[model samples]
Target chain A: MTDLLPRSGGPDPASAPGPVRRPFRDLSAEGRGRAGGRWRRGRVPGSLLSRVERRERRWSAGPAPAAPASRSLLAALLLAAATVTTLDLSTDHGPVEAARGVVADVVGPLESGTAALVRPFTAIGDFFTSRSALRAQVAELQAENDALTDQLATADVDTRRLATYDALAAEADDLDRAVVAARVVGWGAAQTFTDTVTIDAGTEDGVSADDTVIAGDGLVGRVLTADSSTSTVVLITDADSTVGARVGSSGTLGFLTGRGEVSDGATLDLELVDSTEVPDRGETVLTWGSQDGAPYLSGIRIGRVTKVYSSLRDSSVRVEVEPSVDMTSLDVVGVIVPKGTDSARGLITGSSGSSDTSGSDG
Target chain B: MSPVRTLVTGAVVLAALLLQVVVAPHVAWHGVVPDLVLLVVVAVALARGPQPAMVLGFCAGLLVDLAPPAEHVAGRWAFALVVVGYLAGRLRPDVAPTALSTVATVAGCSFVGASLVALSGLLLGDPAGVGTGELMLAVLASVVWDVALTPLVLPPLLALLRRLEPGPA
Candidate 1:
């Protein structure tokens, strides 16, 4: 700000700038007439000078600040208005498959089916896990199953697969009951081998683009594009799929971005931008929250973080992740529409959570 | 020229664009999103022959850039879509482009686009961490979307084109 100072000056401009006091000092210009004229307007100019000085002080303290306060206020008001308008623009949420409401309907069936189908498989796979308790549980399930029929006992195995399956089941049920559903009507003729799947849901279905789409286990991908009655779903396993996540048990926050496609049981890497909490091999990765600009809903499971590595440049750890769902065989899915736009940060988190990015603001 | 036919086609195009904006968003493959702009071009070309398709493609591309964050040069998209429209015009509506073909086209185009974008880093001697694997996944996602949804749009659009053309069945 002082870059504007001259090489040599008659008066110290910092204490009293020339722009404010120039007219008074320049009275030598017209001698008597100029001095007499200045006397009449003296008080007015002095007050105006004080006002200008105060403004300059504020201006010199920061760069391009006036624009942001006013702009952000305007943006806030506009965002508020948009949110209110969105609230009223409710999705009729009809049962027809032509729109996204079917997504709501399908979420329940798909999640439960996924939970039911994948539970036993993951459990049996985990049966040989190094834990004796796990082996004992499997043994108990086998003993229980020996007395029952094979089909009847398998449902029991789903029940006995440990808390992970239970969490998955409950989460799946919640996803089913709490989402919008869409039919797999239009597949882009060319790009069918992708993590993205287009459905017959759209903005009119109350399904805004960018809402997180999920299944029984947890996060998949968010809606990147939308139409009136159709949208595209990007799966979490997509190499480019990235979301802000946290270790559910540890609360260690980080962004979990997809590494690449898994091949032949090989693990896909999930790079973490932070490592405040060292995520164990088995800790569940969950979305941080909508407040952090999550593309998906809060608490939607993404995957379990694995293969931890520390980067030399930063303190954060890089890890591998496996999405909760089988990207290869997705049949139906759920769209978790963000509930409301007017956040409770100001109203709930109090002054602490609403801190600005810069501490320089006084 | 029939004003009715023109209006109908215009409506279809608008609907497609609007749907692309509103509906097609939910199904994107993270950063590797499906190209609704590309989809509209391919469908229109398959439906209404070439010259008209090229014009429509330019318009759709512009609309895409105007999406959430409007672009400075909508004209740039006009260039890309014109090519997509022209190439699609040459392809047969009768044959289905395979999942691989869609991936190949999108991946090739995205690679070129990505390379153009990478120039921002290159000039500064800071070549970006171009996640080759992730981008390929995106290309694959685009292929999946294009293949899965083409029929839904193409069948209706091709039929509409037949109706507009002065020919005997």
Candidate 2:
């Protein structure tokens, strides 16, 4: 390695025939010729002597006797790991889940603290990367705001009609649930074959498993599990996730499956139950809601269709959707928790029939 | 290991875990983040040898497996990292290694570790398993990320560990 270094003002020590040494006077030889020569008058530096001694010791020691011990340790650990994996895979609600919860509880605070410290830098990075997208969003919102203002200006002439519209809007928005707000604190490890995020909220904050999570734009995912102070949310873009979806105003029903990619314009695959019904590009998709809205709330926007493909092996059509929420840069999110079983039942009674029909078809 | 060395190792592992969970995701490229803990394991192996590396690898792997937001079965990372730690430790030289050799070992271990985890997930019937093409892409991405990060992560880590332990070369 020293040979790789540029030469200074002298010959390279590495290229010398003998060991490199400092050009010091031969004081030990002078003392040897004088007196009894039993002891040298001048000696090598103590540090240098010790370094040479250490080198000799290292050479004598050779490979340490720890090789066998380490081999045995490796074998033991591998076996232990295999046991844990088998135990975890063989049982549901096993000790592994409890241990995971404990680990999460311990690590949650540190993750959130680190996230708080690091968020600003990440925001700065995001600003630069998505500046063009942000500008486009601003323009789109401005146009929408202008259209809404025009509608408001003409509303006074139809006060009765406006009242009914307001009532209908309230009804549509009413899921009889409370939203618990949280910030994303961490994400799944790179090795884990799942797309998930950790949020700084849990059962204590009324964020429970199966509750619907959403960002300002649209649906994010559902709470997979909750510890005391943190919860894991399996993203809608996870391979294992599936959401019942309704296509545009056509009401064509289907199920959306995640493609498991999120950073680079990740899209979900929407498979319509009625193979003959074709969805047009740009049609919006929304969650049709499950019973009691446990996993997803009805009317929450998912995304707009970008492309449609007809299956070569079957009559089914596959619609690709870019999620309304950017799964890559999640920040503040809301978890929708049903107020109570009674309230949830009351809210679901009217729509239960239609939902059941859609569910059956899907 | 001495108690002080053990404590320092634990601290470093914990810090790596925090960074892996909090910072890695934000820096991900194309939906893949570098495995910081895995890199730490390799660094430990290179500096301390096989025994300590295996112990650290197992413990750190368990922490990663059980960390929040992890949806797959536990211990897959543990198993994979143990093998990586062993391989990296076995590659350690009697003399200090050159920079090029160190980087190559890191890249090789990263590839092996990522592939092991993915293959184990597939063998265990993980629902999150992707198709072969996507799996290959993810593994390659992780290797690239780990190699890119070695210069930033490994040198400082090796320095710190050598300071703490000061073992025979």
Candidate 3:
């Protein structure tokens, strides 16, 4: 029974006295003469023997001589990382920002190239995920197209209405303000937790920080930082972002705050200034332009009021809004450059009539 | 590390960054993308031990911090990944690794990395106002995604790095 159990001592079976019948696999193929060579050839593969030899070498080496130096190197790197974090947090826009800008500029073109390369693959993914929805949309669009074609056949009345509609659209779009068109080259938060995107256009293209970004559908976001050829746009769905909004036709003022989500079900929270005024469901929300239109432009459609909750304790209403633009599938966007100081004069004179009409039509 | 190996490491890091920036968002499950850079860093630690791994982690983290679309303070990822690399390096097994142990190591390192980032954000006051629950959720998601990705990324990466420089011979 004792012979059946292998010894807990070293690999050398010779040290143990009388006829210890060791397993063939347990014997090391070193210093055992002919029997070891026979066992090695018959049972253990060449690769296994080499692996065991390597393990033995590693065990004999104990700790590598380079261990202390590596430890010091790790400490130094950790300290450097800490220093960078402190500098970035404490200062407004310092050397770290500059370094970040440099990195952005370097990586921007590469990102855009990769995005273009991968667009078709991602589109295929989207197609499979939303195949049923796409089919429904195609049917809806086909019906709409047929109706529009029929309207076009009655040219005279339709043409006049179209002219009037185009005029209204131009005014609502703030046509006087310059906009730089750009493609969204990258997505995800990168290192930060905020929801953001990288756009191809930047300061070189007259895009700058605090500029309003918009898609064809509605407001997209605001530019947070601009490099020479690229910029970071903080989406409206980012947790820290807030846009002043005008609710319904009454022009009741409110603030739309992001909840930091970008799924199809993501929604913004609207807090009305007048808590007693309950906004009806489906009321349209539009941007109440900021001072000088730096961060957000006025009259742009934000979303519709999906749900409203009346709070008993504070007597305040919490309204939920589904954004007009799909935050998850951003593509081409425009950065609204604040018209020069000279254009400010034009805005003031044209303000009164436009501001009132900017309400629900958007 | 030899110059050729260093170059290979640099190339791998750059490729991981590009993938994270361009492809990650498209592949995000519930708005959480796996950290490819972190996975690569951890893999390197497992392959080469602590010193090279920390250096690679710091460099990779700094790049991630400075990458476009990043809005928070820089170096947060750098600090987080440095600790991740060191701990992962220390966790390296002396014997040949089984698949289960490798998966466990990747999951543990990923959890620690995600937790450190959340903790740093909490201490420094995240502007996003992420709550404890949300932070924990993010950490959990990161771990799940990374662990899921380990089979696809880690084995190929480990094999490649091992080929680049044979272990401590």
Model 1 misplaced stretches (Cα beyond 4 Å): A1-177, A184-212, A223-242, A248-251, A259-277, A292-298, A311-316, A337-362, B1-53, B59-78, B84-169
- For candidate 3, write residues A251-283 as lDDT tens digits: 689999998777776899998988888887867
Error of 2 at B24 (Å): 1.7
lDDT values, one for every candidate: 0.46, 0.75, 0.75
> DockQ of candidates 1 onward, in order?
0.02, 0.47, 0.44
RMSD of each: 27.5, 9.7, 8.9
Best by DockQ: 2
Q: Which 10 successive residues of model 3 chain B have the least lDDT summed?
A: B92-101
**Which candidate should be chosen as best, given lDDT against the real structure?**
2
User: Which regions in candidate 3 have their CA more than 4 angstroms from the true location?
Assistant: A1-71, A135-175, A190-192, A338-362, B166-169
* Residue A179 alpha-carbon offset, candidate 2, angstroms: 0.7
Per-residue lDDT of A146-174 in model 1, one digit per residue for the tens?
Answer: 75565455554334434544664544343
Every model: iRMSD: 24.3, 6.7, 5.7
Clashing pairs for model 3 are: none
lDDT of 3 by residue, B48-113 (tens): 777778888999999988888777777888988888888878776332344566788889889998
Taking the tens digit of each residue's C-alpha lDDT, what string does model 2 give over A102-212? 998989878888999998888998888789888988999899799768967875645654554465345445654556778999988545558899999877776778988
What ordering of candidates by lDDT runs from best to worst?
2, 3, 1
